[model samples]
Target chain A: MVRIRNLRKSYGSYQALRGLTMEIPRGELFGFVGPNGAGKTTTMKIIAGLMRADSGEVVVADRMLSGKTGQIREMVGYVPDFFGVYDDLKVQEYLEFFASLYGMDGKEARRRTAELLEMLGMTQLRDEMVDGMSRGMKQKLCVARALVNTPELLILDEPASGMEPRYRRQLKELLQELCAEGMTILISSHNLNELAEMCTSIGVISKGRMVMQGDVPTLLRRQRETNPYVLQCLSFPEEAIQILKSDPHVKNIASSGTNISFPYDGTEEEAAELLTALVAKGAQIVSFYREEGSLEKMFLDMTTVP
Target chain B: MRHLNPVYKIGLKQSARTKKTVVLLLVYNLLLSGLGLVVFYLTFDRAGRVREDVAYSGILTLYSVMAAMEFVMILFIVPASTAGAVAGEREKQTLDILLSTKITPFHIVTGKLAASISMVILLVISSMPVLSVVFCIGGVTVSALFVFLLLLVVTAVYIGSFGIFFSVCCRKTTGATVCAYLAMIIVVILLPGLLFFFECLEAFGSVGYIGIRNVMNTISGKRTLFLLFNPVISFVSMLRDQVGRGISIMNSIGSEGGLFYFLSRHWFAASMVSQLVVSAIMIALSAHRLNPTRKGWKSGRSG
Candidate 1:
């Protein structure tokens, strides 16, 4: 649904986005992961038509992002990392206001406002002043406001930032439900575990460059080839480690109590063969399992590239 | 086009709730009528005599009051209203969310400007009782009052334009507020003071009065040209001409046959055309400022 090519932006001497290129497929929940100052916000802003890119092409919904900014704005719902609400405006009024901006009339705006507030669990706060609501409630309200126009693509920058755990779970559920409804979402969050659980696809950015982007399982699988997996033994852990280290496919080994971990580059057959050889050597098998690969681990491995 | 655009409804609600706005309107109406009542009572006994001096001095004083009132109101209101328009949005961090919507920049600019001017007009209308008191004395016709109201609207439009412009340009509320105030000071007090000083020099035979008169004329003409750019000045000018029978000092000096007499004869017609042109320009300029995504004037479209 979204494609960016050679997207570059600079703030004087500081380059925020450096020829970053990536594409997000339609109806997929894309997770954007990056450390501080990684051009995540810059990229999102360009897509939202809120800021200009120095040079690049962004195509969304078959229209050039920059040239057809108005159309693009109509197609996308954006929730910024930090946001504020009109103090005296009620929750319903706030939602209705944004709905109207998208050309929704009074009756239509009221209908959409009611639907979004209910969906986001903000119906109780409909008549409450915006300032009187809690931080989590306000964030949910912002999300509802963004959804007022029923945008096909939602670009949310840290939508779960200040929410309590329960509300955060509610936001996750709402996002999952939206994704299930075939709405594309590009979400950025520091909470990698949540992102890993929620996102079907993920992109890792570092220093304005897309270090990696693809399906979550594929990325995890690729990174796992180089990841160290631990093998635990009830006894003779050192003997098990020594046996694995001697194998050519096993590059290195580290031990913790009765657990021994090593970087394995062999196929599943070879790994199974090595385990059989260890059993033949009389090493007691307490636990035999490969380490679970997650987006958080892959993110740490890629972005921590010093 | 959305009948219930959040920005529009919220803007109107906020205006209604603002204590400062409510108090300003009340005080403005009470003061105008109170002072106007006293003027009427004093001149009630000499209603016929007031018309005799409908000459240069009478027009000049009226112009002064008109200018002063609008300038002062702008000085007070623009800072309070527009200083917070964009800057507050940024501080709230809601600008990004608002910009993300289909509402064009022009729409946002205009919506804010309309909200502010609505409050200003409310304040101006509240003083109508005082204006009605002027009718107790003769020579101030209803047509004249209509012209005066037109002038006020024009001047308000002009002043309100600058407020929006500055609000858009400045990143911080304090910066916008200070810049707006400074600009007003230059337009209302400083520019006139400089012109009058030069005129005084001409009076002392150091330079020709015509030279000083030309400077004032240029200023007045420029002011008229940018009338919509600053409505406070136009409103004051119109008020002086309609209620007080005074010509702007600059116009008086610049035009031949004593500029005041010239304006006194064609007050309504001249102001109507001049202000309309100025208001159009101001509105267009404001629209331009609001559309930041557009590199410059070209074949660009607004959402």
Candidate 2:
């Protein structure tokens, strides 16, 4: 639904985006992950037609981003990391106001407002003033506002920030449902586990570049190869450590109490052979399992700047 | 129409629903009534023997005082109101959301300008009863009253445009307000003052009077064009015409009678067109600043 090629932006001496490139297919929930200053928001802003890239090409919802932002804005729903609501404006009025901006007539705006309020479970708060609502409620209202245009591609920057777990879960489920219904969503959040659970595909950006991206399970399974295998010894932990030191595939082996962990770069047959030798050596192994990889771990491993 | 700008509605709704708007209306009308009463109270005879011409003069004076007060209120309040329009949206963090919509920048600029002017108009409409007090004695005409209202509205547009320009140029409302007022002080007060000083030097004390009309009549070269930008001079010129037959100050100075008479007779019309053009330029500049492709606002990074 969105494609960026070699996008670059600089603020004076500091470069924010450095030849970044990525793409999201139609009807996929793409998770955008990066550390601080990794240009995730900048990229999203460029795609949503909120900011101009210094040099690059971006096609969002099949339209090339150019001098005309109006068309792109119509096709894209953008929920920034930090946003505000008009005080003294009722929740329903606020939603309808945004809908009207998208060229919806009064009848269309009312229908859409009612539909969004129902979708957000904010029907009871329709008459309540926007500023009087809680922050989480306001955040949900912002999401509803973004969805008012029924955009083809939705870009949310840190949508789950400061959200309660229950509401966050609801937002996740809502996004998943939207994706299932053929809407393309590009979301950036610090909640890696939530993204992993909810996203159909994941793209990890580091230093303004797409370092890694693929389907969630496939990416994780590929990442799982680098994960360390940890062994727990009921006894003879020193013997297990000595065996690990002798093996070239087992590097940086760490032992604590009865547990020993190290990354293994061997095939399944070689791994089985090593385990058999360790078992026959009277290491008294109690448990040995490869640590599963997570989105959080993968994000840290990819974007942690020294 | 359904195509009315929603931001305008949002601005009007917020302004109307706030206690500040209510308090402003009450205090403004009270000040008008109280001051109108005071001008009459101090001017009228102590005993119950007021003359007709004196009463007529008092009503005219009352009309003049109230009109000047409203003009002054527009000069000050319009700037205060509009200087925060765009900057407030930026501070509230809603500007990005608004700009990211399908609404054009022209809509944002014009919608905000309309809302600001609407607040001033609301004040003027609400105070009509107090102004209507002039009709009790019979001196001021309804057409004159409307001219005053039009002048006030034009002046609001004149001042509000600068306020919005500054609002878009500055990051904070405080900065925008300060800059707007500074710009107004220069245009309304200093521009005329400097031009008059130069006119005084050129006249070399030959003129009998040292007033604006005299200086305007005596002003020479392209310097007279600068006074067209002064809103205060425009209103004062318009006021001088309505009240005093405007004196023969325009035709009395040398053979260059044509330009002076035209300006002296139609200062209001000339200045209205001139100021509106300037205001349009300011609005266009502001819209440019809010342009999405412009490298204006600081872009925040996600990393």
Candidate 3:
């Protein structure tokens, strides 16, 4: 769990973070979304205790993280967007080095390294030089290094950047599995679809500020007053459209041959009654479904300048 | 006892793994052996036509030359070893990841400095056989050789710390290396030169005033204090002491009644202590520079 209050940071005349405040609860998979130079990385660094804020309060796991670095470091595992691996180090040595930095004993570090290498599917390449590996493999090793300490909170900054889709999907599933195991994760990325699929909650930042943040479904529902519904019929498409147009809640009707789509502002009971009404009208309906709003649309709607 | 520093361990392992280190050691050994053979041939060639005392003196001279050369080698090699330490981490984008760990900044700086100094120590120890030629010729004692080795290690640590300080302060490795060398030049050459210039001004009147003979005597008497932290002067003084000078060059500079006179009288100890103090200060400053949450410290750009 992380809580930030009115965090403000400036690099000379440039303001990187301004009055940014947000909170994530325990076991929540939070997605941090922002455009370029929006202070997403800045906030992540501040939480990771790798940077100092001009003025703010950051509390992670109920401990004040500003001046107390030892506890914060123990709790947070940070994966930077771009990081270099030691050229001469094998994958195993790299993980062992980081684990030892955290004061893990050699035996414990070896055990944890083995477990992490296996979990990240890097067991085959344990003895391989990190420098010779592909970028995706290197990134996975970086993530594994972070997890070596078994941190309760994982702070990843654009971790999926420059990765092939396969690696990205693997990372996504890995994060989802970790979140399921009660690890709180705060991930920042430009990939909206991936975040939309994996995140339990989302926060959108713009211009050094938090513009909007909430549960995913709540955010989507708030972005649109009425849910869009599509109805597909084998026959009587015109009669179906007419029947839907007559409904009080149905609006914005558009007909494309056998398919009719419209916006419906109604509860589930009303929607079910409408479906029954269409069935009773001798309309051979093939499919009737509500179209869920995409996170990309919500993100653009929230982030685009007025 | 506190569990070998992870950074130090990693640095040592990486340095040993590289072929560059092996090749460098090989080249270093070749150079020392060549220089040793040339000195031996020249010394014996002259001794064959001269008295027995001349042969003894030649061996002493050989000892002094090898010791001075080792000091100079450390001077050139330590900065190159350490100038790229923190700067390389920043350039390779591994600094943030390292900092994000629980290791303190002091640990990182000390680990880097220790790693660099250890390499220099390894080179010095490997050259011991070449230095033992003086022992075989009966001019240098084993204790003197050990003392010289200790001095070399201390100098390496001092210069290495200086380089690491610049590395932490500069964003680029080239800048750090240049600044480190410039600082070394100032310490080795400019400091002594300025001291001599001041003594000259005291001895021969500057402007319209006649020279104050008494003040000139006092200033000249304490002139050796200026070389207290100079590695070359310290090396030469110790070499002179080992080669039957009966007294260190430091005590012969002059005699007066002050702290400067005491430091000059015990120049070897003063030099070691002063160099260590300077090294500690530089290492502390470097640690401060790398600390992210420290006030007035700038944050490096992160990905």
Candidate 4:
């Protein structure tokens, strides 16, 4: 749904992006993760045609992202980290204004505005001033505005930034639902935990470069040797920790009272065998399982300087 | 080809919410009408007050007030209306979101510029009664008032476009507003002062005041062309034509059958052509300003 190659954006002496290349498939929810000054927002802006790239090419829905900005704009829906709402305009009016800008006529604009407002659960507040809305509500309204044209590619930059926990969850669910509906979504976010939960694929960027990009499960599996496992014991937990720490396959181990978690360099089966060995040695084991790796770990691992 | 009614709706609502703006417009209209009525009452018992000298002063005051009001309105309203147009969107971080829509940059520019001047147009329309009262009391014709109003609208649109253009270019609203005002002062006031000052410098030469006279003659001749860029000056010329003199003012001031005389005889066409050209340029400049990829120092590198 989107392709970017050798995209570089610089402001005076500072380079915001450096030959970043990425592709997102149709109906996929791609999470863009990076630390501060990682060129995430800059990449999104270039793809959305809000800023010019110093060099390189971006293609959205098979249309070049240069002179075809109007076409690209039609195909992409963007939600920025912070969005302004006109103080005097009502929620419906704001949506309608965008609809008209999209070339929809009066009747059609009104119809789409109503539909999107209802979809975003803003129908009840249609008459309310947009400025009077809560941060979450405004965020949702921005999402509604983005979807007013039913864009094929949604480029949302930190859409859930100021959203409360509940709304964040709702936004995640909504994104998942949209992806299921065959809408491709490219999202850049600081909240790795949430992105990991919902994104089908993820891209990690550092210093204006894409360090790693792949499906979440595949990324986790490739780095599975770094996965930590917890072994809960009913007795002799100290001995269990000492044994696990001494094991050649084990890298690091930590004990929390009866619960012990440590990195396992060996296969899952071998790790299970180690747990069995502990039990055979008169260590009563309650449960032994691998700890799930979150996108947070993957982000830190990718972005942290060597 | 899209129907801009939705933009129109939002624009109207946005302007209506500004109570301060509405009150200010109301005060302007009341003052204009009050001043016109006062003149009418004062001149009621006088004989031959409508003659050249008396009419010149009364109408000069009226025309001056009208031109000044339009200038002040454009000065205050354009910046207040358009200072935030694009910069504020960026500051609020909504510009990216807005640009991501199917709306082209041109559409966004037009919609924003339209929204800015929507209230100014409404206030101009609402001032019609007072404007007509000026005509009712004075010797000015209805066509003159209509033409003046048209001039005001054109000036407002041109000024509003500049404001939007600057707002789109600058990252800060304060900077955009200040620059727009400064540009206005240069075009309307400072440019003329510089021209006259040069003429005075030349007057001290061997040619004496003859150089000054020639310069003044040139200005009087090309008054319409000069005033075309400065709407306030054009408005002043329009008022001067309506109240004091006609094509003869050019001859009395200096040269005969020059640009001012030609414009005085064809004020409508001259004003239309000049305003249309200026408005188009302003609109084009504003559209160019909205281009995200346009060549500029601040243009970010894309990687």
Candidate 5:
């Protein structure tokens, strides 16, 4: 779990994070979506303790981050957007080297390296030089490197940037598996649709501010509340109007010829009953539906300038 | 060394694997071999013509030249190898990943310096054949080789610490390398230049260079402390103790009963101890600079 409060960071005259506040609960596959220069990476760096926030209180894995990086570094794993490989090290040696950095014993490091290489499907490439690997392969290795410590919180900044489509899907599945295994993952990316398909919860940030955040279904349902249930009758309009006007769940009802639309504050069961009543009254309903709200649509609605 | 530093492992493995190290080894041995053989032929050429003791003492000259040459080579190589230690990590974008691990800042600095020191030690050890040209003939003791080897390692560490310190301070490898060399230049060339200027000041308001050593005897003892920072002066002072005054370049040699005389008597120990302490301090400062979350250490200028 991570809790960031009013995190502020500045690069010269540019304010990277200004009063940015967010939280990722335990076992959360939290997606951090924001436009470029929207403080996503800055906030991730602050949480990972790779950077110092100018003025803010950040609590990571229940430890209060107060200028001490070592205390939190052990609990948080970080994978940067862009990273280079050691030119001389083999893939297995590279992973083992990082495992050793976390103070793992030689045998433990070797076992962990083997396990990670297997998980990454890099067992065949373990002996290959890391520098000669493809960009996508290198990115996957970095992800495995971040996990070598078995950290509780994994902060990934644009992890899928260089990954191919197939690897990106595998990465999503792997992240979901990790989250299911009780690891909290905070992944930031520019792709809302990709995140929507995998993330349990999502947050939209803009101008160093968290504009919106909620669970996927709840956020989508909240957006859906703005749309009205419409009913268009090809015939028998008077009977449908009479049944709708008598309904207590419908408000702001408007009927013109056979077309009717109104806000409905009722459960699905109650709506079903109302529709039956309309049929019983000889109402011929041609179209009766509300449009579904998507995460991308909501992200654009929140982020795009009016 | 219960837990060997991971950085040290990688640093050593990568540098040793490079063709540069092998080439350097070949070049170093060849150069020292060339110098040694030249001295060898010249000494044997005077074998029958010169006295027996005089011919043997020529071996001492060979020893001093090899040791001095190794020291200078270390001076150039250590900085070039280590100036990019941390800055190169930054350029490669691996510094943050390494810093984010359980390894402390001091650990990284020590690992880097240790790796470089090990490489320089390898070079020194491999040059033993060329140096055996002197010891094989006789005159220079094995104890003297041990002492010189120790001196060489200490000087490498001292110079390597400045390079790593500059690596931590500067963002660019070029900037860090330049600063490291400049720091060495100050300690090697300028520090002794200051001592020479002090001798000149003592010789001022007098006629000519009237018995420079005699005048140096009257100078303050504190002036000789500056020579402690100059590894070359301490090395010559050290070599003089091992051999005799034939090779000493120390200007304050005859300052009787003064601080200069006291320090000059123990110049090798004083310089090594002083430099080790300074190296420790530079390493500590570098470790401090390498840390990202340390408050009040960062320049507010960046952001």
Candidate 6:
């Protein structure tokens, strides 16, 4: 639903986005991960039609974002990392206001506002002033505001920032539900695990470049080839370490107390065989399991400059 | 009719709903009533008797004061209303969200400006009943009142445009407001002062009673060419002309030869048109400043 090609943006001498390129298909929940100043927000802003790139192309929902802002804006819902709402407006009025901004008539805007409020669980506070609501409630309102236009693509920059775990989970579930309903979402956040649990695909950026990006499982699998294995021993941990060191598949080993972990580049059958050999060599193996590759580990591995 | 611009609609709703607006309107009316009472009291003779001509003159003075006060209030209030319109959005961090929508920068600028102008118009309309006190005594006509209202709106547009332009140019509301007020001061006070000094030099250079007449004529004449740019001067001249004054100082200067004469003849119209033109340019510039794709305009990344 969104495609960016060689997008480059500079702030004087510092390049914020340097030749960055990525594509997200329709109905995909894409997680954009990057460290501080890694240009995730910049890319999202460019796609939202709130910013201009020095050079490159951004196509959202089949429309070019450069000069076709009105068309692209109609197709995209944007939630900035930091946003503010009209304090004096009630929750319902706020939503209705934004809906009207998208040219929805009063009747349609009211209907959509009611639906969004109910969907976002804000119906109870429909008449409440926005200024008095908590930050989490306000964040939910912003998300609802973005969806007021029923945009096909949602570009959220750190939507879960500064939220309690419960609200974060609610947002995660909401996004997943939206994706299930055929809305494409490109979200950026520091919470890798949340993204891992919800995103259909992930992109890792560093130093203004897309270091790695793909389907979550594919990224994890790619990391798993050089994945480490941790062997927790009831006894004979030293012997287990020695055995692991001598093994052809073991590239490196580190031991602390009863646990020994090492990087293993071997097939599952070979892994089982190696475990059997360690057990046969008088190494008490209470638990022997390959470390499960996670999005956080993959992100760090891909983005950390060696 | 087309649907109202959403920004303008929301802005008006929010402004109307605010308690501050209600309080301001009440206080404004009270102040006008107080001024009217004072004018009423001063119109009577020392023995507490009211003379017909004096009462008529008092009503005329009251109308002049009301119009001038309304203009001054609009000048003061419009900048405050609009100087923070865009800058407040930026400060609240809501500008990006607004920019992300289908609305163009022109829509945003015009909507904001229209909202401010609407408030000024509201103030002017609400004061009409107080101004109608003049009609009771027979000094002001409906057409004259209509012209005064039009002049007030045009002046509000002129001042409010400056406020919005500065709001778009400045990152903070406080800075924009200061700049707007400063610009108003220059246009309303400093510029006229400088022009008067130059006119004085011309008046003093010539000799005899003609020189003195030239001085009086200069004050009544070519000086208006410069004063035409000042809304205060234009407003005062309009009021003076409406009150049975034949051939205003501006018109007298227009009776002389040269380009100043042409400018003098059309001084009021030229001033109104020129203010509108300048306001239009400022509004366009503000819209341009808000546009992200415009060349040399800073994008969200840099911001």
For the candidates in turn, chain A alone yields TM-scores of 0.95, 0.95, 0.85, 0.91, 0.83, 0.96
lDDT of 5 at B140: 80
TM-score of chain A of 3: 0.85
Candidate 5 per-residue lDDT over residues A1-306, each given as its tens digit: 888898888877788888988888899999998888788887887788777888988998788987777979988889988765686899989998999999998899999999998888889999999889988899999999999999899988888996789999989999999999999999988787899889999999988899999998898888887667878777765766777888888899876776778889888788888888887888777878865778888888888977
The local distance difference test score of each candidate is 0.72, 0.85, 0.85, 0.75, 0.84, 0.85
TM-score for each predicted model, relative to the true structure: 0.87, 0.93, 0.90, 0.87, 0.89, 0.93
- First chain of candidate 4, TM-score: 0.91
User: Model 1, range B173-225, lDDT digits (tens) per residue?
Assistant: 88888877786666656765665565566555544454545544433333233
Per-prediction DockQ: 0.40, 0.62, 0.54, 0.50, 0.39, 0.56
Measured by TM-score, the strongest candidate is 6
Off by over 4 Å in 6: A237-243, B45-55, B206-213, B216-226, B245-249, B256-266, B299-303
What docking grade applies to model 1? acceptable
lDDT of 3 by residue, B176-231 (tens): 99999998889889998787667666655644343444333435545556677788
Q: What is the C-alpha RMSD of each candidate to the true structure, in Å?
A: 5.1, 2.7, 3.5, 4.0, 4.2, 2.7
Q: For candidate 4, lDDT tens digit of each residue in B92-165?
A: 66665666666666767777778777777777787777666555545677777777777777777777777787
Candidate 6: what is its chain A TM-score? Answer: 0.96
On a 0 to 1 DockQ scale, where is model 2?
0.62
Per-residue accuracy of model 6 over A212-259 as CA lDDT, tens digit each: 989998888888767789889888755656777788989868879888
Clashing pairs for model 3 are none
Output the TM-score of candidate 2: 0.93
**Order of quality (TM-score):** 6, 2, 3, 5, 4, 1
Better of 1 and 5 by TM-score: 5
lDDT of 2 by residue, A280-306 (tens): 778888787888989899998888888
Tens digit of per-residue lDDT, candidate 3, span A1-306: 899999998888889888999999999999999888889999999999888888988999999876658779887899988866797899999999999999988898889999999999999999999989998898999999989889899999989898899999899999999999999999999889899899999999988899999998888777654558888888764565577879999888888988878888888789999999888888898998887777788878778988
Task: State which docking tier applies to candidate 4.
Answer: medium
Tell me the lDDT of model 4 at B260. 50
lDDT (C-alpha) at residue A244 in model 2: 70
- Model 1: DockQ score: 0.40
Q: What docking grade applies to model 5?
A: acceptable
